[model samples]
Target: MSPVIETNGLVKRYGRFTAVDHVNLSVEKGEVFGLLGPNGSGKTTTILLLLGLTEPTEGEVRVNGLDPLRQPLAVKSRVGYLPDQVGFYDAMTARENLAYTARLAGLRGTDAAGRIITALSRVRLADVADKRVGTFSRGMRQRLGLAEVILKNADIAILDEPTGGLDPQATQELLELIGSLAHEGMTIVLSSHLLSMVQAVCHRVALFNRGRIGLTGRVSDLTSAVLGGAYEVEVEASGADVPAVLGGAEHVTGIAVAGPGLWRVDADADVRPQIARRIVEAGGALKNMSIRRTTLDEVYVRYFQETKNQQEKKDAEAA
Candidate 1:
């Protein structure tokens, strides 16, 4: 099947500045795809282009195989968007807010009312359906925004920073709701700078850097490609030659001293046994040793750092 959303060499510019540069992205049906980057790194611009809210300076975009630029109304009818700062009438009740949205979408009467209730229930906001939005917490407001999307019965949902500023409990609830949406076969395009949350909910992610995608793939794939390993063994040992001894172990790809007597080892496979045995043989006192999968946070940092270094080297060579 064709991708629900696809962009090719997408570019958007404002005066002399390029917001999105030569971006080629594809989001499959029923999968949660994440767009991750720091603020002002082109994520929002890309979303705007995809939503037909802004015209791209160059390149192409298709939503469900239809040109968003040419068939904007069709695309808009099928795609739902929840912006970072969703707004509603302060005095309006939650259900009322969604009712207004329904009317705007051409839904009416019994059908609209039924969808509103279902949407509220899906986002777990049914109990607060009659509460004024002004009285709702930030998390509740976010859920209400999602409810509006659900009411549209959109084929795709684009959520920008959905969990931003939310507390741990709220974030978890929102993430669970997002997961359920994907499970029910809604294509989701999530944009956020929160690496951990993206890692938690996204099936695949594209890492944006300076208006371009730096990397795109699953977290584990990116971890292996950028960090040289998928497993990280953290070792806390007291010995002058700890680094040297651990470095000699087979499959040890990289090692960094996290702090005094603390070292993080990256390896392709589980090497905790090798690490423990090597430390013991080296007469090092092992305070603690643990192994776990590498995280997106680590991959993001290392990938960008490496990209920066490579660019610096190229500039130096040119000069």
Candidate 2:
């Protein structure tokens, strides 16, 4: 099947400023795909382009095999978007707010009513169905937005910062709800600043940096590939020349003392046994040693830092 969403060298610019630059991405059906970046990195702008809310300066976008630029109505009908800042009739009840949207979507009477109820129940907002939206908490508001998306019966859902400021419990609840939606066969495109949430829920992610995709892949694969499948061993030993002992060992790339008696070793593969042996051979009294896999957060930070460094070098050379 074709990708549920596809962009080819997508570019969106505001005159001299390029908000999205040569982005090529494809999101499959029934998967939670994440777009992660700091603010103003063009994550939102990319969504806009996909939705045809803003036309791209160059390249192309397609939703469900139909061009969004040419077939906007069809694309809009199949896709539901919940932006970072969602709004509702403040004085209206949750049910009322949803009803209004359902009506706008051309759903009405019993059909609309049933969908609204189901959507509210799905988000665990059924209890507050009749409560005024103005009285709802931020978390509750977020859930209401999800309910609105469900009520649309959209085949694809694009959520921007869905867990932005929610507390732990609420964040967990929202993520669980999103996962359930994916299981029900909805293609979900989630954009957020929360790395942990993205890691927990998304099947794959594209990391945006300076209006471009710096990295893209499964979180685990990206983490491994970005760090060259590296692992770190944290060793605690008394008299061990741990650094010198493992400095030139097979697969050992580098070593450094972390604290008074703690040393960290970076390796391309599993060298736990060798690390232990070298420490013991050097007559170092080993206290403890633990190997840890690289994390998505670490990979994200390193990629952006490296990209920034490269840009700085080019700037300096030109100067």
Candidate 3:
């Protein structure tokens, strides 16, 4: 099946500055795809281009087989967008805000009214239906924004930084809501810098660095088997001799000193038995030895940093 969202050599520029450079992205139907990046890393720009909020300087983008630039209405009708920030009328009640949004999306009469109620309930905002939005706390406002988008029952939803500022409870609620929506067959694409949340909610994620699609795939796939197993070997003694002695052990690829008397050893495979014998022979006081492996954070950093370095080299050569 064709991807619900696809980009071909997508590029967006502001004068001499390229905001999004040659990004190719595809999100399959009913998949919760994540876009990960820091500020100015093209997350927002990509969203805008995909939604036709801004026309790209070069390349093309498609949503559900239609070019957004050519079929804005068709695309817009099928999409629900929760931007990085949401602004709502201070005086309008939660129910009123959703009702207005539903109308704009082409719903009318009781259908719109019922959807308004159902949407509020979905985000756990049913009890706040009568409360004015201005009086709502930051977290509540975030939920209200969510209510507005999902009320339309759009086929694809783009949630930008949906949990950026919410407290723990609110963040968990929103993440749960996103996960539930995906399970219900809505194609969800979200952008977030929060690593933990992405690992929790997204089945597939693309890491963006320096305006390019640096890495993309299932989180498990990226970190799997690649770790080959690792370990943290902490020696209470602070001496260069420890590393010198531990360095010759089989399956030991690299040793990084995290702090004084703290060292992390990367094993080619599970080699705890060999490591223990080696450390003991070195006369090292092995305070702790645990077989640990790579984490998503570590894998993400490794891939992102490598991509950044390669980009720098290319820029230098072009200059």
Tens-digit per-residue lDDT, 1-319, candidate 2: 6798999999988989999999999999898999999989999999999999999999999899989889988888889999887888999999999999998788979999999999999888999999999999989999999998899999999998999889999999989999999999999999987787789899999999879999899997887677655587888898967777787899887677799999887777888899888888999888998998777778888788887899999999999
Model 3 global lDDT (CA atoms, 0 to 1) = 0.82
Q: What TM-score would every model get versus the actual structure?
A: 0.94, 0.93, 0.87
As a TM-score, model 2 comes out at 0.93
How does each model score on lDDT? 0.92, 0.89, 0.82
TM-score of 1: 0.94
List model 3 lDDT by residue over 1-319, tens digit each.
6799999999998998888999999999999999997888999999999999899999999999999999999999999999886778889988888888887889999989988888889888899899988899888887788777788889999989999888999899888888888999999999988876788889898888768887788887666433333343444444336678777778776777877777777765776777667767766666766665566677677676666688899999999
Top TM-score model: 1
Which candidate would rank higher by TM-score, 1 or 2? 1
Which candidate should be chosen as best, given lDDT against the real structure? 1
Regions of candidate 2 where Cα sits further than 4 Å from its true position: 247-261, 267-270
**C-alpha RMSD (angstroms) for model 2:** 1.9
Deviation in angstroms for 150 in model 2?
A: 1.2
lDDT, ranked from best to worst? 1, 2, 3
Query: How much is the lDDT of residue 313 in candidate 1?
Result: 100
lDDT of 1 by residue, 153-213 (tens): 9999999999999999999999999999899999999999999889989999999998999
